[model samples]
Target: MRPLATRGGSYVFPLILAITAAAAVACALDAGPVNVWIFVVVIGGWLITLSLHEFAHAAVSLAGGDTSVRERGYLTLNLLRYSDPANTFLIPLILLAIGGIPLPGGAVLVEPWRLRHRWWSSLVSAAGPVTNMLCGVVLAWISAGIDNPLGYALAALALLQFVAGILNILPIPGFDGFGILEPYLPRELLERLRPIRPWLPLVVFAILWSVDGASAWLFNLGADLMETFGGNVAQAAVGLARFRFWNV
Candidate 1:
């Protein structure tokens, strides 16, 4: 990892990255528990990816003529710079730990009105989740060529990337997928959705939580996508099983 000097003076993310990376490496080297390290690696690597996810949005928005994101410090690689810490990190982490479902995380505020064209909004919105998809596909492909513990690690990461990509790409309120469609949404509908937009997450997650077989559907879909992209779902499952420290 390179030196990250940020204007926000935020070092927690780097520290988190260092600790997690060290733990993951140590586990891979047989110096630590495998299950614990899987957890650490997934969570830590996820935080970094969250930063990149937001970066994609900000970067695309800037290129599309929304220069305000840079001024808003959205250009920073710090995870804290992406969105609400509670929403992006804490809540998603808690949910993943307990439910093993990858919830949508992080946000980058881009002024749609400032965009060069309406399509630019779609581009900016699609950029974040697509980045996650690329990471999953690339890493899954890489993991296929390797063996054991290391392959396990990469597979797990790839599975997560698939989960994030699938979840974010759905056209749901308070999700990036829906943001892609927001540009074409009627103003009347936007106004109608205004009050419920905040609660939509709760509603969505609640259904996934309370409904039977919802989590399985998500997991199966994610696994299918990961496999389609050249990832081994079985290995990813082993990695996930090991990482379920609470379950094991």
Candidate 2:
């Protein structure tokens, strides 16, 4: 079997990039349905980031000696390669479109024991969110140079990425943030928490959705990080408004 690292990449990522580029060009031209074009740019870009986020985890795991990630097809960059396609792509996309929430996507499973060290396991967990943060910074840098409406859209997408990075790094159950610390925690505590791991994310999302203060606090932090990265928070908000064009 071909090594996972050598496995061919799926056309989906590049295809989305191409379409998003075209939509961005349309936005540049001040085309009709500008909102729709912005939507395409933001959603398509968001999907690309999601793919990269998971890929970062798999890649780090592979480096840390978890070769099983290869056989599981985690290196493909194909969203379907993940165990749950809906969680990986569909549901998050829906949440983004409807409410502007950038929920973290499906996880790539890693065998912690197979890794070379405890630090490797933690690094593997940290890789995904770090990737999101880096991507957000790069997009923000790109957005900073553009004076067009497309800049707003890109900034909005960058803000989403920043929010994802921040959200994932929180030390909450079922989050990468928690995963980073899992290796250092008492094994007894882990066993106690294991049963509730699956449900915790759902509960967390529910709180964010229903509790105004919680959601505001989260977004406020994201906005602050966006500004720190040189992104225009107000412009990103405008981009988000355009992205949810139906509501505008």
Candidate 3:
């Protein structure tokens, strides 16, 4: 099995770098109460999303016959335990304080070799995003059912989770979705794509940040889906909170 450090370097490092840089730039460029609220909502929403993400990873890994994540103490909601200080704390804090980017939080661990089935491995990798989407759906449901500020907050959180889930599921080289897809891809194709793997994180981040339309489209789609399932109340709550600072 490949070492965790190697896997992270190959897949996670570039995302950290790109997001951190973009965050710094966003902080520098945006100066408004709305931006601040968006930052706060993102932070709160990301915290919940990330925790579930790591939990999904650890859970699936355990089910797949890997005790590595549990052995390493990654099976909990303890943020500090899963977080890499550099990736989760320092970079985000610096960007938020100096650059104005919304720093995200959450973590998960898995052992590739221990996964017995390639498709299962793919499912495990895909679990995080699925969990996020579920979370969004639940939140949206709650928001629509209720008639209060709490409902609005839930709606916002749902939006964040939905967006994050979709973003992570893009079949880019270094993303989790790619990892899930990798095991099922033809060996020849996988091999051919290997050399370019390192660049994928950067490419995904660029596409996400540079293209406002893409991001908006994703968010809208998430909202649409959530509305479809959550009914009118949830849809209204989300719409009401869409431009507001915080759900309140």
Candidate 4:
């Protein structure tokens, strides 16, 4: 087996962080178009979280005996290594902008057969969304006491990440939630569901975007969770409003 690289992290991650930081700082100083900054912050921050989310899946799978993850460069924070750009970024960004639903993006392929145990598959699936939750919690904590435009933007981003985690954990086909339960499900049941897995996420996103009640329920659920975690839901709304500049 090949040893995992222990050297420096991919420069792409740091560059993304730098760009997001620059945008946040600029917004804080009232430099440019508030809408532009809001766009940058939300989009860049979301990309960062997506990278981490996929990395978590790969990392957990690696630990669970899938050395192929390292070979595929999934351990690195390079966004290109994750998945198709259209699915990983474009579609999710469109959904976020139009409906305020942060659909989970990016995916890591974990060879279930290579895993040392069946439970490893569950852990591999759970790791991605759990990372999102942890990110939401940390961002929520950071923005909790700060009452500023930047803070509001952070709060909004936190809410999105939290919602993304929630969406991923839903027990539906093509989601990590289903992946978590797949190991315990019967083989025949899995076979029956296999054909539908590819299009399930798209259908789910379409429902969430096109149906007002469904979108409202999801946003409300996310908002409630954000408030419960001490995030400023009102400010998050403001931030989202700014992020969706076309609506303003």
lDDT leaderboard ranking:
2, 4, 1, 3
- Find the candidate with the highest lDDT and give its number: 2
State the lDDT of candidate 3 residue by residue for 192-222, as single tens digits. 9889987776665556557767556766776
Deviation in Å, model 4, residue 151 alpha carbon = 0.9
Candidate closest to the true structure, highest TM-score:
2
Residue lDDT tens for model 2, 1-248: 55434445577788888999999999888797999999999999998888899999999999999998987889867776776778878998999898788988765878889999989988998999999999989988898888777988999999988889888998978789998998899989988988998899889889989987988888888889888888888888889898988887
When summed lDDT is taken over every stretch of 10 residues in candidate 3, the lowest stretch is 3-12
Whole-model lDDT for model 1 versus the true structure?
A: 0.81
The digit string of per-residue lDDT tens for model 4 on 127-221 reads: 98899888888888788876766777788899898888889998898899999999999999989988998888889988987876997787788
lDDT of each: 0.81, 0.87, 0.60, 0.83
Where in model 4 is the C-alpha error above 4 Å? 1-10
Q: Higher-lDDT candidate among 2 and 3?
A: 2
Q: Which 10 successive residues of model 1 have the least lDDT summed? A: 1-10
Between candidates 1 and 4, which one is better according to lDDT?
A: 4
Between prediction 1 and prediction 3, which has the larger lDDT? 1
Candidate 4 weakest ten by summed lDDT:
1-10
lDDT of 2: 0.87
Displacement of the residue 17 alpha carbon in candidate 2, Å: 1.5
